[model samples]
Target chain A: MKTLVVDYQAGNLRSVETALRHIGASHEITDDPVRLARAERIIFPGVGDAAHAMRLLAERGIDRVMRERHAAGIPILGICLGCQIVLEATEEGGAACLGLVPGTARRFPSECGKVPHMGWNTVRSREDHWLFRGVPAESSFYFVHSYYPAPESEEDAIAWCDYGIEFAAAVERGSLVATQFHPEKSGEAGLQLLRTFVEAG
Target chain B: MLQKRVIVCLDVRDGKTTKGVRFEGNVDIGDPVEMARACYEQGVDELVFYDITASAEGRGIMIEVVRRVAEQIFIPFCVGGGIATTDDMRAVLLAGAEKVSVNSQAVRNPRIIREGARRFGNQAIVLGMDALADRRMPSGYRVVINGGRVQTDLDALEWAREAERLGAGEIVVNSIDADGTRDGYELEVTRVIATGVGVPVVASGGAGVPGHLVEVFTRGAADAALVASMVHYGEYTVDDIKKVVADAGIPVRRQGARPEAGPV
Candidate 1:
């Protein structure tokens, strides 16, 4: 029942720590590849530059460990920038990512209202999965992203959130799940989403 | 659907929650941490803990207060009022606050906005502008600092545009004329700034009722409305204000925000 939140200098580490504690889920924030590999649950919590994060993941060999875990079919979640890097590549920094999921990260159009679609927006997901559990269909979550993942297959998008254009708010296939919004900052319902992820296989 | 937001602002001076009329004489209100937790229970979307005393005294933001509030409240909040540099912004965000607002210091050095936005994401940096109605200014509004005691040459509209260019995720367009007046927001200036910038704009300074929120959200083109005096004085509870806003056709995160979780 070990949960390891992979920390690649993510700024929201404490916030995630607070939420996991709220749901009574004991977890550890680690970058050690061995520790990350052995953890029963993995969450890639991120904020800040994607390229810098990718570089650190490579430098620390966390990317290799993540790939290994994903291949093993372990439950993994990526939040915000953490979610972006899970894809194959990102327009941000033109950086290559782990390729855990089948997608690429692209910037939201500048003319599409705001460059950074920063605020609370709804996620519409019809997919039946343990990730959402009791979460409402169109629940609003706090998002602060200039870029979002465009999954290769439309069915991979568990939830779609519209800003300038509808983008993958949550993408899932098999055991891999990631959200473009911060569950830790998204109030009570968000905490429940985190709890479901932690408790479910 | 992207819903409009209602943010509760707690003006803290010397570690005590305080409120003043038009940024003048102040009176102690209550413990900020306790008050913020209570408001969180009432379904306020977010809270902004402002370091009024520190900002006015030429000191740094009160990080201690931010940590206290962050520890108690689960929802996101912003720490503002004395943030002077990128390091200050980092300290605030690292202290568990989701956003850091820059006001007087931003006017002094506009580069702080760009640097802070570069270091932290733009979403973490907030630009707080105290505006006064001025016929001579291009936008018919001038930027003020130091609790509205000093007015800058920058126009509200122009500065907002510049802030957006420099990577400010949101702007707080506070009207000096309307602040603490209990009339309403200075809609003229608010509209100019909101429509002027592509980023989200927060209508601040004079929120007296829930309808004022609707006025700002619609006519003012604001993404969020900042409320202080109205909530601080107990004229309206957060739930009461939210019900009014929801009743007015504005969507809010009213469900599952209660301390004890249940169906909405």
Candidate 2:
């Protein structure tokens, strides 16, 4: 299956591309909505500010295509800021996101040790899913963000993490799978997760 | 819970990995790209590449090396050592580095921190501080630049706070005195900065053995430990250091026995 990595010019798309290449997955990175709509899989990789990311997505009309692809039930994956932008909104810049999932991205409280919550952290799977296939429970994933997504319904949360607060680390609804942590940067576990996403089902 | 990170710092000079004692007496080690891939295969948590000789012309060489490493490794890596402008930061990021660290340039023009943070989120910008213990400074540490040869009037603690205010996502507190000594991390200064800053603090320099990493994470309150001489000189592998740290009850990503087909 061809994987199309949605590039909204948020931040380093090269890492995601590199990860896909390392896994030997056939993938292409593009901002063009045409490829996004036609791809067998969509990996929305993100970084940077949420407001600016949303602005760029709207300006390029990639937002509409993304929503369309979601509606059609295409396999969608969101990483880091990509995960945050799919929520209803974010406290970072008070930006309204795609609202594909029922939730809001909230910033970690200043008292939460660190702002970005960088480095390695455990992501506990809430239930068995294809995304977590061959991935052990409580496996650590790399995270680098100030905000974490809080899904409205507990059922939508596939995995959870703690950094001062127990928040939704990974969420799933239908064919869409999103993780607040960067699986692309999470080393072996992350690569395995990506490999499963590409090969499983 | 967030686990402490074990970062390998590769100080590159003329496309080769190099190390020195207190920023002097430098000697070339090996090809940076090869070393980087080896570190990745050894399961390093993160990697930092500092173009020690980040001259105008050397920039191209550094970017190429970064690109090569990025292609071979999937983990988060940072590039530092002469990123003066956002354009330079963009070039490094575009080359596949996850973060761009600013040291001497950041001290010279504090605005670059804000600008880099504004353009590329604060998390993408790290403040690489080279500090030395000084009784004259209020924090008992003075900020040194130009690979620790130049000392400034700015107190280490004060500069760390100011840099954070200006949008530095993380601070790497490298002790010049402890660097290359392999005794242990300068715990006092590292702890002061760790507790003083809200962002994650990475203790750099002076890591002789795995015990130093454990001490830095616990006593020093560091979120991560950056090692050089210990691992670079083949004295200890990244796995060996991580095993000792994890044995101390610190939650490190245990992938030593992780198989290619097994659950990670």
Residue range with the least summed lDDT across 10 consecutive positions in model 1 chain A: A110-119
DockQ of 1: 0.66
Q: After superposition, how far is residue A145 of candidate 2 from its true place, in Å?
A: 1.1
* Cα lDDT tens digits for candidate 1, B87-117: 7788878888989999989999999999988
Residue-level lDDT tens digits of model 1 in A132-187: 88888778888888899998999888888888688899888677899999889887
TM-score of each: 0.94, 0.95
For residues A1-201, write the lDDT of model 2, one tens digit per residue: 888898887887888888899889998889997777787789998888899999999999999998888999889999999899999999999999998999999989987777778888889896667799888788889999888999999999999898888999999887899999998888878989999988855
Backbone clashes in model 1, listed as residue pairs: none
The TM-score of predicted model 1 comes to 0.94
Task: Please give me the total number of clashing residue pairs in predicted model 2.
Answer: 0
Q: Number of the top candidate by DockQ?
A: 2
All models, RMSD in angstroms: 2.8, 2.7
